[model samples]
Target: MSASVTKMVPAAVILFGAMGLGGCATKSYVREQIAPVSQRVDALEAKLNETDGTAKSALSQAQAASGQAQNNGQRLDQLNARVDGIEQRMAESQKKKPRN
Candidate 1:
C-alpha cells in the first residue's frame, strides 16, 4: 500500500502542475485575443474626440456667419430707408414746381 501511495502522490502532483500551467496559458491566450479589441476601442475614442472638436468649430463658424448676416440685413434696411426718403423729397419738389 505504501509503495502504491507514493507512486500515486507523484502522479497527482504532476497532473495538478500541468493543470496550473494550462490555466496560465489560457489566461495568456485570452489577453492576446482582447488586445486588438482594446486597441480598436482606443482608436474609436480618439476619433470621437476629434469629431467633437470639429463639431464645435463648425458651430462657432456658423454663429459668426449668422452675426455677419444680421449686420448685412441692418445695413440693407438703412439703405432702403434712405432711398425712400429721397424719393419722398423729389415728389414734394415736383409738386411745388410750376407746371410746364
Candidate 2:
C-alpha cells in the first residue's frame, strides 16, 4: 500500500500541474474564439431582417395582383354578355328580312 501511494502521489502532482497550465491557455483561446462568433451572429441577424422585408414586399404585390385578376374576370363576364345580346338581335333581324 505504501508503494502504491508513492506512485499515485507523483501522478496526481503531474496531473494537477498540467491542468493548471491548461486552464490559463484555455481562457485566452476561448476569448479569441468568441469574438468571431459574436460578429457572425450579428451578420446573421441583419440578413434575417432583409429576408423578412423582401417576404413582406412579395406578399403585398401578390395581393394586388390577385385583386386585379378578379376585376378583370368581372369585366370579361360583362363583355361576353353584351356580345351574346348583340348576336341574338342580329339573328332576329335576319329572320324578319325577306330572302335575298
Candidate 3:
C-alpha cells in the first residue's frame, strides 16, 4: 500500500502541474486573440471622434454661410428697390421733355 501511494503522488503532482501550465497557456492565447480586437476598437473609436468633430465643424460653417447668404439677399433687395426708384425718376424726366 505504501508503494502504490507513493507512485500515485508523483502522477497526481505531474497532472496538476500540467493542468496549471495549460491554464496559463490558454490565458495567454486568449489575451493574444483579444488584443487585436481591442486595438481595432480603440482605433475605430478615435476615428469616430474625429469624424464627429469634422461634422460639427462642417455644420457650423454651413450655418455661417447660410447667415451670410441671408444678409446678402437682404442687401440685394435694398439695391433692387433703389434701382427701381432711379428708373422711375429717369422715365418721368424723359416724359417731361418734348421730342424733336
Residues 2-96, candidate 2: write the lDDT tens digits. 99999999999999999998777576788898999999999999999999999999999999999999999999999999999999999999999
What lDDT score belongs to each candidate, Candidate 1 first?
Answer: 0.96, 0.96, 0.96
- Clashing residue pair totals per candidate (backbone < 3 A): 0, 0, 0
Give candidate 1's TM-score: 0.69
lDDT string for model 3 (57-98, tens) is: 999999999999999999999999999999999999999999
Against the hidden reference, what TM-scores do the models get?
A: 0.69, 0.74, 0.69
lDDT of 2: 0.96
Give per-residue CA lDDT, model 1, range 51-88, as digits (tens).
99999999999999999999999999999999999999
Off by over 4 Å in 3: 1-29
Q: Poorest 10 consecutive residues of model 2 by lDDT?
A: 21-30
As for candidate 3, its clashing pairs are none
Candidate 2, superposed: residue stretches over 4 Å from native = 1-4, 7-11, 24-29
Q: How accurate is candidate 3 locally (lDDT)?
A: 0.96
